[model samples]
Target: MSIKPENINLNKIFIKYLNEKQYSKLQLHYEKLGKTEKQLPAIIFYYACAITLNPSSNIKNLKHAHNLFEMLYVNNRHDLQLLCNMIELSFRTQEFKVVLPYVEEAYKINQSDERLLLGLSKIHLYLANLKESIKYYKILFKINPKSKINRDEFLTSLNYASGITQEYYLSECKNYLKLLETNKDLEDYNFNFKNLKNNKIKIGFLSSDFKTHPVSFFLKGLLLNFNKDKFEISLISNLHKSHYDNITDELKLLTKNWININSLSDSEATNLLRSFELDILIDLCGFFRGNRFQVISNRAAKIQACWLGYNNTTGIKNMDYLIADHNLIKKEEEKLYSEKVLFLPKIWNAMTPSNILPEIQKNNSIFTYASFNNFHKISDDTIDVWSKILNNSNSQIILKNPMPSSIVGEELKLNLLKKFIARGVEKKKILFINRKKDFQDHLGLYNNVDVALDTFPYPGVTTTFDAVLMGVPVLTMKGHNLNSRCGESININLQMQNFIAENKDDYFNKALSLQKEKNILQNFGKNLREKVLKSSLFDTKDFTKSFEKIIQKIISK
Candidate 1:
């Protein structure tokens, strides 16, 4: 082929440089050409794009390359692919906040793309605006009802925000279960391939939260105990390397194989897993919509199961099993789930860094009553119950949540005060602190609290653990669903049942009575910390054994 004078002759040179992964050299080539060639805009743009696609490129080059694309892409309407590429780069670099404006702009330009909705929903959920988060999520859900968004975890998250009674929550689950049962599309999700190996079991664990996430807290012990020699462990992760903590590093060392299928298409993810000869695909993500749940509907693994990370039974028919412990799945409650329940020894083993020892409780003039649950956990009923505790006792209720940046701490405080004032509780008794940071420092900051309080309906498991780890006693009300029952489990294990309440009045009475009895609170705090140190909750070794036995049973089939 003859190169015309205006053609720039950049095609072969750019491709050769990209083929060698020489991004900097390609940039030099683009810069050297300047505006001399008519095709310079396209050539330079593609070369910068090639640099951004390189996995080895750091955030600096990705940003610079993206900026270069922006300069070349003069027509804003024709820049969707480049914008999406930039969004992907920003997401990979842990630049979630930076991606928000781009996503919003993209939605403004083209709101119908499923990929854009997916990206938007994920970011909004991260920001903790559940209502606004759900609005975009539902858009994707409507498109792929059997795909990702309408899964069990998303429904449970919505129910949690609804703040209804335990009966209502159960009723919601039962009603949703009906939809899964009758939906012909969900019924079409069966993957009973004859090629399923009897001897070898392929275990695929999928999740976007493998770091210092709430999901990680419970998964640590299980990941450590999963025997690689007996079963092939394949991890499909959307979480980027920057999200890694010490526990995540431990998971990398433990897993037999790890696949970064974060951005793969549904067919691509399914095909990738099938190529691995997967016998069992475990949806650790449940229905949370982090990574490739649409792949789950395809049944990439022969015997699919779900456990740990999400609390509810995934209503997907292709999901054959829902892994839970005896505590979480009673025979009576089995009807509530679509998938057959595989009961483990305990609900799920939680593993925390051993260094987070409980501090000795010291006397303070003002009794510090605090709960570090997310702001969403603070529903109308939860605030009402909390107000009763503060009203009955002449003490301040200190609330810590990562809400102020989304809204503001003072605004949340004002909202809570309004709730309390409506219930005739004094406004001065409520305190609110809202900020966001890495979990280690965030959990460590709870040492300033005296007695930790657990929210009802949608109670906290990880937050409760974080509070207990700081040697603060948690007062809890055990309700119907697993959400409300976490505090009871922790209290039972810690042998601090005095803090367990049966009703709203009882919860208030206990909080009030405990604050009055300082000596009793002190004695309980010391005893509780000692009990926790001796309990299986903190005993990684014992938890690991239980996890191993369960995996053995599953793979032995």
Candidate 2:
């Protein structure tokens, strides 16, 4: 079980490669030591340390590495680090069911360890165990209140697809401000008041989701249609270089001023942005992740606004405006926000789906329901509702999100089936499909779906838009908060007000009714796209014009 005296230095070399993240070097070492009798122990060690950790590892290699890990774990069951590594390896391989035992084993050794706590929280979140995920996050917050990364994760976990109280959400967002002790002395962007009326208003948008995200999808039409002569737009991107793609390049071309603040410190990012001398700065990312709270609180522009990036109010005091529509944020609930509501006339955002969309496919034999939103949004209540719909209608629901192919995917599906089985839904009535990677392929999923059931409290926005675009009717429930009302706004704009439900019971009844109304479904399938195309939601030009006028009005004051 130990290396020979002469080969002891190999262990040090392995540590050096791993510590330095020299994965290639580790791979070379693992390859060099392969299939030798005397080096068998070292080979097994390197398999986990090197092959398992390889970023570009193939499925075969990962499976092999997992097998070696199981062999190693049998004798090293007491080793905490080994258990943690195995847990991580299982994660990489999407074998989430196998990780629980490893996590439990690691927990016995040290419950308060940050890594274990973080891993636990994330896995729970992934599996839609919101209560447990929040429990670990609360524990992490109590352990380290000032940990920015933890706080960001904690904040994101709070805003689930299901709803929370407006007051509670507001309080937590305000508490998020404490993490950034306001550095008010940040150097301000100088304004040329005398020449301002004659110059193009410089508007800067700050966000990490400039790629193929929901934010990017919704912003596409507006970004494309912004009047170049009237507004000088600058994109401040917080996305890392590795994630940059064709969409990023396309977004970059939307404006001449594109800055990457992904790697910079808060002070550095703030100064660089302030250096741009933007007249209006928009916080597209409130607190999801990579949120520059310090910069948001400090000065970087003449006017700062919070928009579609977050579902709730960003508690930054200096955030002057929250871009809204009457459908999104109500006048009575306006008191919950820290900023002035800049209400647009019709809709807050509009979407332009892929120019060449995939043709919708239909299943005539059986009724099919689907949800394409993130798995995190699938609350227990939402699951129960969907189950009821399926049970009543004798239909199936297809979850076309990012579920893996491993035991984790199976377990997640099984976990869902258990919930449905309890509610008297057949396992066969609940279908699970892994998400597609390509945009066309992703949209192609809607072909199998007849009606897309929107998640509650945190209903689908982009997914709702996409389903409507794909000619599938969506059933959504209205909630009090911004996240909950996104579906309501979209449905109203689509002129499909009947699709919007007053409550969970309404949502259920509507879904069953939609399933029963085959003639309506057929007519909807034929005309929904044209309806969306004709609606305000698809009129990018007008949405942009309205957006500009709102900005002009706000800045004029």
Candidate 3:
């Protein structure tokens, strides 16, 4: 591992430029070295710095960087730092396919590098290699037991793996929670509520997605319909300043108190929340990004509960309850959650309808099945089942691409096409569509679909609402856990029990059965909008009253 004199001189210049933050000079230094002789290490270092400085560099620059790295790599320079830096750049640019080999090579060079191991784990997860992802994650955890980021990511990957038993999921989640609890001390706050004398109950909602998000879509109706005389609502928003939207404007008009806490530290946030003296603090985000679990873990309010953003348990001891309907969480599954289950009467979420309507289906000769869920949810099992449905009937499947603009997105699409082709499905039959920017256009795409197919182990929540609202029937297979049963809950609330499948055979049979009953489907599609409009799913006023009653009961106790 002795360094060459040329390499030593190049490293000295590189370190000097990096310390001085002279990125352009670093590139100039490489150009200078190139004139004298081809300095491979210097060239690779130059590209790495360029990519690091400008992550949004165009494809031409990225291709040049990749070429430089490959040239040195093939020549056996095998610099561990250079390999890791290139892998990180690829990840930053969302070029995940470019990262795999670099990570593998880095692992071979130094198996002890935590950064390389983490990147390898993430790369496998992105490629949908769940077992490999888990293996690398376990190795990383063993190497660094105190890394919060690694622990959280490991729990998330484990949660998404198909066919994981509920017992195993709960055990892993609990272990992760224990790690979090041990690493961070909980904050304590004392408050006096003795001054209460027939005043409105103060309710606070905390979330990062207070605008243009699934939580906002369901939450707006309830906010608009709240009985102002009985409740004073406060929105503790974690939304970044750039993400403000018209929906945020509407929310502001509905509530008098709107506090932006995105810039606040956990201690500062908790102090502000305690100042408001909120009777009930509702955590709309559970385990999702931008979650202030630190504040929640500190007991920011008299009563705190989790809902909407995540289906799984928060595993925080301070979180009092999990808001769900009986249909979503069965009585037998209560032990799986750390929080006490608070069952809503009918639907747990209230829907805010889109003004745009789906165009009516003209011809119903052949069936078109669709799913707009994220690409990660389409596991091997889901593909296998879906392929069977497509193979058995005169059907075509439409899947909305999760990230159509990225290289990783393109790779995922190709992988999916290969899977379908292996299962005897024509490439043309499986249509991968880019997501529309306009919300109305997104809804209209469902018009082209006959019956929407729900993903397994993790079902669609907002997408299901959007599909059915647009007169598209969704067929779902119920699962053993709360995450899997979201579709079933929606179907049950719509009073469409026949659309719920008990098993794989049942799911296929139900889909096949729908293909034959064109008249029934046509009629169902025709009347769906009206049916949903009348159901508890869309009855926000009544839903608000019921929700208010629950809040009042909790406060009284």
| lDDT (C-alpha) at residue 141 in model 1 | 65
**Ranking under TM-score, best-scoring first?**
3, 2, 1
Candidate maximizing lDDT: 3
Backbone N/Cα/C clashes per model: 1, 2, 0
lDDT of 1 at 93: 49
User: Which candidate leads the pack in TM-score?
Assistant: 3
Give candidate 1 regions above 4 Å deviation: 1-154, 162-201, 228-231, 241-247, 289-291, 356-358, 402-428, 434-444
Q: For model 1, how does the per-residue alpha-carbon lDDT over 211-323 read when each residue is reduced to its tens digit?
A: 76667667666666656566567667877777667867777777778887776766676777777777677777765557455576677776777876776665566778877
On the 0 to 100 scale, the lDDT of residue 96 in model 2 is: 72
Over 1-557, each residue of candidate 2 has an lDDT whose tens digit, in order, gives 75576567777777788888887777776677656345655556765677776788887777677766766766677655665676667666666777676776676677778777878877787677888888887777678776655566667767783546778777877877776654445444332323244378889999998987878878778888988888988889999999898889988887888999999887788777766777889988987777787887765677899888886787777788998789978889998988888889998888775679887656556888889887667788898888778777768888866433543465566666677788888888877777677878877788788889988767887788888888898888887877678888999888888999888888888888886675745678658887888888788899999999999998788
**Cα RMSD for candidate 1?**
8.1
Candidate 3 is scored at a TM of 0.89
Pairwise lDDT winner, candidates 2 and 3: 3
Give each model's whole-structure lDDT.
0.66, 0.77, 0.78
lDDT of 3 by residue, 302-395 (tens): 7899888778777788789888888888898899888998888987888867666656553444578899987777877888889898888888
**Sorted on lDDT, highest at the top, how do the candidates line up?**
3, 2, 1
Better of 2 and 3 by TM-score: 3
